[model samples]
Target: MRSSTIRRALAAASTVSMLALSVSACSEDTANDSTVDFGYIGDYNGVSLLAIAKKLGLWKEVGLTAKVKAFNDGPIQVQALRAGNLDFGYIGPGAMWLPASGKAKVVAVNTLAYADRVIAQPGITSMKDLKGKKVGVPEGTSGDMALNLALEKAGMTAKDVQKVPMAPATIVSAFSSGRIDGAGIWYPLIDTIKAKVPDLEEVASTRETDSSFPTAFVAGNKVKPELTSKVIKVLQKANDWRARHPREAITESARMLELDESKVKADAANVETLPTADLVAKTKDGTVDKWLNVLGDFFVRNGQLESAPDPSSYYTGDLYTKAYAK
Candidate 1:
């Protein structure tokens, strides 16, 4: 296989990775007086909320300790949450299906207006250009969602192109070495690919078809609403701090997540972190619900789901309101 810095990092890591702050415990059901088992994506696509929460001591301020674990992607994180291995998880677009499919409950929106894009070589300027080309994307991810939607918009489908299912990190070397004609992935690594393939061009993005692509925090069906509320509260505090100290937030997140600070900064460039107050307002005004519906439809049409479930069944916007109200 082709190799690069990111490829090496991802290959060296596993789905059940532990965060730097994670405490090794024998039992998965370790929720107790103060500690909660939390999971977040170990990839760069993940927002730094959990990392920030740990770095700024917001967890202690909120009177809780998080036993954080890192997973390779949203789907794996959701799997852990569903199996009761996690009290909570930070997830991407998979939130649309996980909750509706009776796997988890989305408690709050973490980041909004973020994107997963299809980046291609110079010659592949449009989605249609990829009709017979090999496209690399970690299947069952937000990136896969974007690629399918973009293909549909261009009057094509996944069958029209060769789909190479690889982890996000591997896409770097795959695209750079011309092993794949294009890649559907998110940033930080997108920037990394650009540096390797100077003529790299983003042909499609989630923002094109969906107004907003939001990442969220999820909990199992049995998790108490109170605990989720407290977690969201701490996340809100960290989001507030992150907005005020953007550079420091990136550096601190890099330190906490064991990623390069420069790459983290580049990846965060287009990510828009909404305040808890704003998320509550959006939920009240039905904007968030609409986003969820759009996301659900995307999955259904992509054949990932039998049908789209009602937004209310999965999204609990009241949780955001309640958390921010505190």
Candidate 2:
């Protein structure tokens, strides 16, 4: 009787062990099929892959759902990221300082040669003409950096101009009503500004001075690598779709952002988003590292940082490789 009782207890223990293992497997699978929150600027001015991914339902197709948030600028996005309110954000090179200052990590490259322009009134045809004028700029942005470079090249400084702090969207109305003499902004808003001011002149732009600017997908240090890798995979798919269907991409972006399709097209013309292969290659080949270093050096010179941080400390191409290999 005693031997039979002992056998029954052992059998029951084995059964419970098997049941727990099955439940653990199911939970692991469920974790793999979860939602991710993403953030980006609320305009068509930069690499808007998050919008494309949201429009195409690519995140769902990849076994993940995206909760997308649109921010007015990079600084707001940076705050959300640091507070753990976001799982990922697509930030422009202007805000690359986030990573350099140890606030975030760049996991993948979004676009190359992402440039901004300085638009002035008809008579303000040169950078020197910006002196003593009320110039609207989204400070601490790529446009602001571009304006600085142009000013430096022209032997001028931000002090030379009366800096009017404003966003690109606001720049439109202020500039149109003559509240501001000039604006340092990105496209398709550049075209929109021109429409409002018919004689707006392109005084300077990154197309000539700062061509190495590249936007990136950044995440907080605590975010899981697997999540970023999955996001990059979705981005790769969205980028390919955009490259293959340029007109549709523009229309969809405009519709999503609630902007005019014509303006979106004009903005698209000024930007070059890298194809998947090239993007993957660049990340793997240390090109992204070089670009981030250039961005860091710019901030240092602008008095934002004492020195540039080593790229490896804040950037990693491993995620790109892992996602692509999958």
Candidate 3:
């Protein structure tokens, strides 16, 4: 994944993933049918499973069609879902928390572990050392959540340092140019930063956090109770194919994200594909509950939410276990 920035450049030479997608193919004619309108966080490696599924034709095999939409971040996905837009969505805790606070339900969590990380210079051995330093993050997004989570763990807060809201690419540049002391980001952007500054290294990761803040699929008003099983089956089918065809999976994902194949291949290795049943079991044991609690607390502590939503009312893993049962 080293030196893996998309050199091809986007429509405006932007390094961020392009937001436009061809939705005309899954047009109105199929909208009234079983074609599920799905949304995904654009080209992000951790949540790219659904993108791979769409490319592999996994939806149609089970008598379903998927209308895929791409968004730059989770907040956008949350907005569409809340307005009765999608049946299911792939998002991180950043946006997932909003829908969960409203009418959304998390049916499944994939990629229990993530490489979206907090990296700092070698001198900063601990999170506390970041105090008073300039830290780059895509503020009000999952990047900030990961960064805040790290800070909270170190008995610190966003106020402890200067928070710079910038794109991941910009953050990488800032860090390299000594404008920012550290950054909270994910691959392949993180890969680019590391490639340029070998001395910079990861100090915290969502994977090591007490709760697993996995990228999850949230169902909204468009999802009927009976359709939950079918929706997840498509994801499982995609996961099955991904395991069988790792090369094809990465190649297709690279095409979708418009990233370098080598970088996608490297990013793919850092992603975790978990079974739906395992997620259900984890939820039952209060793992997901704890994560939501921690997330809600973070929001309230940071004044992002007036009140934390109830976990029982919105979050459930029961749907996942029931989906696979004969």
Leading candidate by TM-score: 1
* Each prediction's whole-model lDDT (CA): 0.72, 0.69, 0.65
Q: Which stretches of candidate 2 lie over 4 Å from their true place?
A: 1-28, 31-33, 45-48, 113-115
How far residue 270's Cα lies from its native spot in candidate 2, in Å, is: 1.0
The sequence of per-residue lDDT tens digits that candidate 3 reaches over residues 133-226 is: 8889866566777788888788888899888888655676788787888787765566667767888868787777656566677787557766
lDDT against true structure, model 1: 0.72
| lDDT value, residue 257 of candidate 2 | 55
How does each model score on TM-score? Answer: 0.87, 0.84, 0.77
lDDT of 1 at 195: 72
* Over 4 Å off, model 1: 1-15, 20-33, 43-47
Per-residue lDDT of candidate 2, residues 1-326 (tens digit)? 00000001111101111000001111234465366666666444333565577667776665676666665556556778889887777676777887788888887777664447888888888988888999998777777877888888888888999988886567767888889888777765565556668888988878785347887777878888777777788888888888788888887766655566775676667667778888778777887778888888888988877899989888868777778888
- Give the number of the best model, judged by lDDT: 1
- The better candidate by TM-score, 1 or 3, is 1
